[model samples]
Target: MATDTTTTAPARPPGTVSWWRRPWIAPLAIVTAVFLATALPRYVGLDPARSLVPTDRGPAFYPALVTHIFTGSVMLSAAVLQLWPWLRAHHPRVHRWSGRVYVASAIPTSIAALVVAQFPSGGVAQQVANTFLGVLLLTFTLLGYRAVRQRRFADHREWMVRSTALAFSIVTNRFWSTVLIAAYAPGALTDPDIGFGSPEIEGAAVASAWVSWIVNLMFAEWWIHRKPKRRSRVR
Candidate 1:
C-alpha cells in the first residue's frame, strides 16, 4: 500500500471586499458628506437654533436642531469605533466605554425624535413619517438590548445592525435630499423654500430611513440563512 499526503491551503478570512477592510473610510465619508449637507451649515457657522425655528409652524424646530447636533456627534464618534478591527486591539476598555456612551446617546436622541415628529414643521405628512421612524428606532433598540440580555448573540447582532442602520438615516436622509434637489432643481438643495412636504423633498427622508433599515435587515437575514439553505439544498 502507498500513502499519499496533500496539505490543504489556509482559508481566507470572510468579508465582502478590500474596501470593506477599512470600514471606517466608508462611514467617515458618509458622515462628512451628511454633515456638510445638513448639520454643519446650521450649527458651525450660523445660529442653528434660531434658523431652525418654524416661523409659521411652532417650537419644534429648535428642539429638532439640538437633537440633530447631539445625535450627529454621537453617531460620528460611534462610526469611528465601528471599525474596531482597524484599531489593532489597543484598548478594549475604550471600546467598551464608547459602546456605553453610544447607547446612552441613542436613548435621548430617539426620544427627542418621537417628540419632534409629533409636531413636524412640514405638517401631517412629515409627522406621520417621523412617527414611524421614532417607533421603529425604539422597537429595534429594545429588541437589541433584550437579545443581549438573553445571550442570544446572533439575535443581538441582527437587531443591533438593524438599529444602527436606522440611526444612520441622518446620513441617508441627507444623501437622498441632495439627490432629489439636484435632480429636481439646480439650487433646491438648501432652499428654505423647499420644506419637508414640498414635492421635491416630501417622502424622501422617510423613504430613505425605511429603505436603509430594510436593506440592512435583508442583508442580515441573508447572512444568517444562506449557509443553512445551501446545506439543505445539498442534502
Candidate 2:
C-alpha cells in the first residue's frame, strides 16, 4: 500500500492581517507622507493661523488643538513603527514599547479631536462627523491594546489595523476633498468668483469628513479578511 506523506502548510486565520500588509508599502507610505508633509508645517510651529481654524475660536481652542497635534504626531509615528513586521519579528521588545506609546498617546489625542470638532469651520455636519470619528479612534485603539494584553495577537492586529485606518482618515479626507473641490470650486476658481456656492462646498466637505473614516474602515476590513481560510476535503 502507498501512503501519502506530503504535508500542507496551515492556513492563515480568517479576519486578520493580509499577506501584503506592511508600513513601507506604497499605499500606507504615501498616505503617511502626505499627512506629515501637510500637518507638521502648519501645527508644529507656534502660530495660531497655522491651525486654519476661524480666529473666533476661543483662546482655549489653540492650546487644545496644539496638544492634540503633538500627541497625535507621537501616536501616528509609533503606530507606523508598530506596523513594521521586521521590528515585531526580530525585536519584539521595541515593538511592545512602541505599542504602549501609541495607545497611551492616541487616547488623549482622540479626546482632543472631539473637543476641536465642536467648532468646525466646515459647519455642523463636519462637526458631527468628526466627533464620531474621534469616538471610533478612541474605541478601536483601546480595544486593540486590550486584545494584545489578552494574548490574542490576531485580534490585536485586526483592531490596531482598523484603528490605524481611522487615524489616517485625515489623509483620506483630503483625498476626497481633492476630488470633490474641483466640482465645488468652479465659481471660486473663476475670475469673477460669483455664485461661489459656499453652501455646496460645505456640504461636500461634510460628506468627505463622514466618508473618510467610514471608507477607511471598510477597506481595512477587506484587507484584514483578504487572507482567507483554506477548505479541506474528506475521503
Maximum-TM-score candidate: 2
| lDDT (C-alpha, whole model) for all candidates | 0.61, 0.79
lDDT of 2 by residue, 39-71 (tens): 878877778875654545776677778888888
Q: Write the per-residue lDDT of candidate 1 for residues 66-159, one digit (tens) a residue.
A: 6756675685567456445533155667765665566667777778777777766445766776677777776877887788679896897677
How many backbone clashes can be found in candidate 2? 0
State model 2's lDDT: 0.79
Best by lDDT: 2
lDDT measured at residue 111 in model 1 versus the true structure, 0 to 100: 80
Q: Candidates' TM-scores?
A: 0.68, 0.79
Candidate 1 colliding pairs: none
